[model samples]
Target chain A: MSDGDQMTPSRPVRLATRTVAISVFLLLIAGALVTSTGSGLAVPDWPLSYGKLMPPMVGGILYEHGHRMIAATVATMVGLQILVLGFRRTDRTTFRLGLAAFGAILAQAVLGGLTVLFLLPPAISSAHAGLAQIVFALTATIALRTSLFWSRFTDAAPRAAVEHGLRTRASRLALWAAGATYVQILLGAIVRHTGAGLAIPDWPLSFGKVVPTGAEWATDGVLAHFLHRTFAWAVAALVVAAALALRKLDAIPGLRRLSTLWLGLVALQVALGATSVWTGKAVWATSAHLAVGGLLWIAGVLAAVLLARAATLSPAPAAAEVGEPQEAAA
Target chain B: MRTDFRSDASKSMKTFPASRPLWGALVPLAFLIAACSPNAPEAPKAPAGPAGKLGTAVVAGRVTLEGAPPLNTRVTMATDPFCNGQHPGETELPEVAVGPDGGLENVLLRVTEGVSGVYAAPAEAKTLDQKGCAYSPRVLAIMTGQPLEIVSSDATIHNVHAAAKENRAFNLGMPAPGTRYTRTFEKPEIVPFRCDVHPWMRAFVAVLPHPFFAVTAADGRFEIRDLPAGTYTVEAWHEKLPRQTFTLTLADGETATHDVAFPSVPSA
Candidate 1:
């Protein structure tokens, strides 16, 4: 209606947030379906098919074209979310996060095009997948922020606490955990795109050997597989450590519950990873493993962000910004 | 009201804010955008024309094995034959060159260049498909103007790399898992199709110009047809046997059959 109406402080309800979150999750599931069906090249030619807009969607063409269609829908809705943020005059953090998410969506689109034009080159495909994980994390973060837990997670008290010197260790620990989780996500991308999953045919032991020993170990195939397997071990260790650290700060019920969920997700992810290998890269199982990995990484990052925010929320010597609640924390 | 003060504060803070490196993200975005350019496979040349089809030819043979029943031997005739105008003497022909079970070896016949306005291919020419891990028909006879279609029926991939002269060479990949392809040669060339994927998979395609060829049976019997009522030289050739040549004349509406015995050679 009017400019004033656009700027009016109209807080979106929790139901709307849940609906958006569910939609994003469904989009991820659809993507997993595309990969599992091996429809990546259903439409061999890109940008146009058989020199027409609607080429016959037979064979691989249907899968690839369907993936593009769903991706476009996701991009449009995410863009709409950014517009809504602008119109609603949400928190400065919310507006900035929306802009970042929009940029990521555009980047993801470009990457998808590159994946096609490059004939699915392993490196670009891997990077495209890594960026997708980041987008998934961003959407999940937005959902987290809009939920009832948002205000508890973004408590602006952390920066003031660092200035006042209380609960400082907890904030630093959570930041490190978040960074580690991000690295784990990148490694998982490398594992999938390098075609290394089958290199070490047998699970745990590579080529019936303990260490994948020998001078040939320096090769890209061997190295990528070895690094991925090693990182799985590291992920297990870091996730357990992060959960323990969060356990020490049990006062925040939300963070504790999230930490436990994060640990459970990590365990499921590792089991899926092994099953993917043991099952000869069965399409359905591999896709499920990918999906769970994305959810686990997002959950890990969300928990770290929330716990760090809560750690900084301990009371201070002086009351500031009275009679006003802090903007939704996340 | 605190509104004016807050507006001024926000505006001033925005103006003096740190210069964010937009290129930090833009650089990677550009890198990703340019990632896969110039990587797709180039389109191949368009196909030349419609492929030729298979035709029928009447073949009959008679063979006489000396001092034996010629049980499991073969004799053949050819049209458009590769005689090269050369024939060996009858006395020089080897004895017992045929297999113990009466199997005949090399027989060169011709679908001679022209007969009654029709081209005659060399007799005794064959195309064999090493299909299903077994030779298709276990025997074949090919003539001129016929391009052989060698197919793989095994569940594994195979390559048909014909090792022959007088034809272009090709080492093509087969479709994976239950895939087959057909290729034709317009000229006579003995090319061996070998599967590099499965080196054990191999077949031979003999290209000829006319339709006159036969593979000898286990009984050493042979036949020649459409002789044009003229005198012509006949020869038998086995890849493993010394060749034998004979002279015969064909009259109109008459079929000529001959039997020749091949003796085995002593071990060196």
Candidate 2:
């Protein structure tokens, strides 16, 4: 966006904002830990672990209650972020973004509570996991928007970016990639929550076949696993396609760097996914896979937002500048 | 709109302290989150078991199906080659073992209520053997706080994941044959025990306080001997059917008979 519309906050404010995103990402890893270690139902109470605010952090209770404590902390951080935005009372757009983030985090916390209270129903648990990505992306975006880099970043003129329609093309591709990545995360959540991560048993191949069929199709576990694997490929393909398409474009240097990072994250995600399976869903490997998936999702979302912003980068033109009939038709 | 971001950025650092409100906000939320859990079980409320001489009363019963039994789904063990090799080609689980006379097998009978006195757990640990890649004694009954020794006979990797809610849940892997693991549950709940390595392998563990419990045999006959003479509440539980609860009274050296039939379940 143009410098005039950019929301610039000080370094400390930016760091405080990024801290919320970092904590939420850490919370995501803890949630993954709860599922990876089969500890989802370890803490047998709502909002409390073993009826206490803090139970003996032994066995599975460690993962389950650890997630809760982090979640509680995340909620507080979100509330304080909104309060800080309000206190500044400058950058009204960021204040609104903070308000939106507050709403999302609250919803995320309530979903988490319901997931535990209801004994980790696959649907609620999956929703809780899926929303975590959104919450992280939101907070991350707030942090991104408030950074000095964002304030200083001004794009080339619309006339330059509009020719070849590279800006429009890159933005569309990035949005599609982001959407696919989010769906892939949801599918991964389903695979985790339904106890389907190991349903196929054999990694890189399902029951020693390219495509598993027959009786396994009738079970929820196999079905969830198959869908997740299938959709992961789709996500990877979309991301690479976006990155490749953006490579042919020009004038969006920030987005180009992000595209490369997105590609690298996707490759790491695939390797982690396989390693997680090969390790028999080991706590560390599976948790790492999920953690990497969280990072990949953040990058995907950031790329999309950045590309979209860059596509419309030039400040809104005056009424006299609307006479580019060729560009408008294209 | 006049926007001077450089000056605004300088002003923001002076305006905000992020930690103070965060700590203040967390305290109230913590209290609210803990509100619903006021009476959650601390630790399986003092183990309850029979604490007197074993009586001679016997409760014999036959559980018959009122209608046709549901078709047990074909269990696929293709994921684990060892399990798949043990039972070749599409094996149906023994969940719905119905005799010609409509007698149902694997129904668990427990005296859920009216059994008095806190009994001490038996010194001898109950063995839950995993043979033929399936949990033997598919429906097991044991006292709370009684040790359960899990032993696998298959020379393959297996893990016992007891998906217990009331009691602490555990997932222990058995990497080789004859690997033994012992655990004692503290609460009275039907724990669904399964081998995570073999998804098709599953069993139910009935953790009861007293010893007045029996599982239906091949012919659907269940006999629980040594139950004390008293009016006791017996619960008949089948995995797929609604549980049946009834009261039974017995005298010393008396043999009481109870015949129960569960409602028809839809065929697969």
Candidate 3:
């Protein structure tokens, strides 16, 4: 093996890594389309569409069957990626992550089946959604680590302390931000697939009253909806906080710019959500809201992964320098 | 007190036309009463059309099948008049079933109002035939206060039950094929029909106060006719779907047609 090849990957494998990442983003969009079209239950009975491999794609079958088709495609891509990573590449961490992504995809497919068989019980559906986001983030991380930009970050100067350093604070803040954003997305999925979007009606405030009106509390459906809206507020706050932390890290120009974009998307997402409610969940508005939410999630995960990797690599240059002498002795 | 009572009775006798032959005097008495009223001063004028040509309002539509058997179902349209008690004509069509290729027979039908301004068809008149242990048409539209006739043509007995939220619950046992009973829906609702005997047998009935509705045929076509020229909200409701509403304007001597297609169900 070549000296650089032993540490880094070959160009083809790196290219494959990028392809998988792009595919992950595509899969997220596909999932969003399924949700936007209200095709979650299109295939009424799961693991089969009307008890056949190819059922008529009319009505519910179109959405449900389409979801299955997309899922199967994603699964196949993940399998291929795993095989390529294991046999064709020597990077242990990337290979392991690929395996983890594959495992998650399988579990997600099972959860999806359970959701359909049980008539899309809310919890399973939310998990299916959440896992997809996680898998998406994982795929993205793998791609980021293999990119040329990541190599440039390797030689960047290390910062001092967690309180004052750009790398430390941004990394710490972004990890929390990613976690909160994911949970918020899961809550949104629950809100949507559970028919809770219209439960609260008035956006920013629910039922012409805030903190929930007692009279409507008796209806569980409405309560679920109210909770979803409230969680949206929490998500907004977290995004703003994440943006402020990014501003605090003045040294990392790329991350600061990325966080700004992330926050702007979040703001737009909040507006779209409001318009969706105001418009009485018009199909178009709801679909746009869903689409924007997916974008925000992707952005948040991207920001987190970049910052986290930056932190891990903060000590890498010094260690590499210390190890250079050992290589000379050898 | 006796004298006062006698005087009042004598006055009433003089005013009332009871002494003459009862039938003979009644016509004159009715005429005098009509003359005294200003609103009916001209008497009850008959409409200017042949009695049989009494303007017919039609609710015609097609029923299509998505899954399961091609349904041969019964669809009914009737009205419970709120303003006037008199409705001239009541009509019904035979059980119309869907074909294997998801085609439907035209259920062109009408209904007249019942006494007390409530519209109804006889239980024997309104029937949904279960020919091969399947609801002939998976959907039905009938007027409120009319009985839904569920008939079993199969050899085995079928227990018919309707899960209705706004109407009284009906659970009936059909003893055998050719045995039938009629159950009335006193209230308006969209009730889902089910046969407990055949778990897969499912149908829907929408009991409306006015007979201004029709189900779309397999070809996704529907026509509502003879509506008084005005603006009204026409709603399309499917048992398993959300209700879709459209506003329609009908001019006098004009028939308006409305079409509705349900968004396909999602694939599992």
Candidate 4:
């Protein structure tokens, strides 16, 4: 290993990063619960519940307040992460990512407050939900960058000139997949918050046909639902292509395993999405759909991070020697 | 190695300078835990017992039609096969029901004004049943604070949605037969309830603050007994006709008969 390659994060920093990531994941689930239960207006106040530090936990109030508490805990975890990064990490990119996450969380909190203060206007509520996925992706990225596997992999140089083009192509593919998945997530948020989940009223077809009958396209609900479904198909195609590209690259087995896992998650997410519509947005199905959507997004982000890290390592003769045996075995 | 990593992280968290950043995170969290640790206070109890005097005065009335009643449209339950199968024959919508004697059924009669007293809601729940993809007793009247139990008798799923202007709106799904749900309205208003799953199924609920409300029977007869006598404006509302009002002054123990007639219009 080169002297510069040895600069992986200490175990403490990596663990802290994972903690923040997990906290953000839990926060996402809690937020999804609030949306699923339609409890956004339970407390009817923000920053402070019912004009006090704590509000009565009853009915919808419990879900809404519980979501706030989870969000507050995540914010604190991220804040601690930032503090730790400032003191211990010298990597400018990681530090900046931490700062960006903190800013995203603060903005998310304000958006959440406004969503309640304004009685959950669809635009603000959708934005709040969308921003949560973005923040989760951010934290997930930080976790990936600080993991022991990432440190070990990035420290090792690439071995084959033959692997260079494949790695770059796979990284670009993963990035596209991640970007498309995020757009799909945002579209889904719009569909959900705007009460358009059941607009199409049928799965695998729109209104029992490939295209809805006349004037249906003009309706906002139908349009949003159609576009979300269409985008999901596109995202699925992109993810599948990325997974195939990553499989051909000579990289760490962990990255290969994660690529396969991403494929599986995307498949499960599609089933969940279908069930969400088929059941007319049953609370359990819809909530699970959302949770799986978040997980799919994290998987995509992790894949992109790993591929991007692979793209940076210098080519080495050992990698070329190792690639021949793997190619022959395949 | 993973265990060592966790312990090392905890050690770092402990040994990290007890400075502004560490305190900034911990203090608010500590305060949050402390503030939210207490269980939520119990909801305030409702007022005890009726706040009105008992009297023997009764408002007896019949709702008669002055013109031809609007034709009731036959409801099509094509959305759900179960609902459709339940009614092999045509089921007429109960928007307006007129008796052979020009007496109106399903007309809601209530004391609209001038009689003021706190009347405690009955502990018994008024049931609104969803059967054969239709709301039974299409027009219902209940005291404002009385619970309305909604039960579905259909094998198919039915979503009960109450769209009330003056009360909290609730939308619930009953996915199976015998599924029961209850809700209460705190304000006096005419709430339109519908089953979204069966778009044609609809009902209306007249929530009054007092018990001086009744729906006209099949024979167009209605009676509201036990009224503390005073000048009261009684209003009769029919779903398809303009409302009719009658003003009457009653003395203690006096039974007043005020018959109302609604001039029906063309079907909507």
What is the CAPRI rating of model 3's predicted complex? incorrect
Tens digits of lDDT, candidate 3, A1-330: 121323555587788888887776666666665666555544433344433456544433455566677777677777788787777754677777888988888777767766644445578888888888888877877776666666655445244223335555666666676777777787788887777777877867777777776678886578667766777777878778777887766465366677788888888988988998899787677777766777677777777776765566454345355455565454
Candidate 4's TM-score = 0.58
Q: In model 3, which regions exceed 4 Å deviation? A: A1-8, A157-166, A315-330, B1-268
Model 3 Cα lDDT, one tens digit per residue, B1-268 = 0001011113243222223331242234333432332111112122232222113433344445345432233322112121012212432222333456554333222222221222333334467877655576777787666656667676544445565667555444443466555566656677877653334456777776655556656555677654555556666655544445656555566665544433434321
Best by DockQ: 1
lDDT of 4 by residue, A199-278 (tens): 89899999889988788887769998999998899999999999888778644647668778889989999999999988
Per-residue CA lDDT of candidate 2, range B144-177, in tens?
8887888878866555667788887655545457
Q: What would the TM-scores of all predictions be?
A: 0.52, 0.60, 0.54, 0.58
TM-score winner between candidates 1 and 3:
3
What are the lDDT figures for the candidates, one per model? 0.53, 0.74, 0.59, 0.75
iRMSD for every model: 22.1, 16.9, 32.2, 16.6
Which is the leading candidate under TM-score? Answer: 2
Q: Candidate 1: what is its chain A TM-score?
A: 0.81
User: What's each prediction's clash count?
Assistant: 94, 3, 28, 3
Error of 4 at A183 (Å): 0.8
Q: Is the docking of candidate 2 incorrect, acceptable, medium or high quality?
A: incorrect
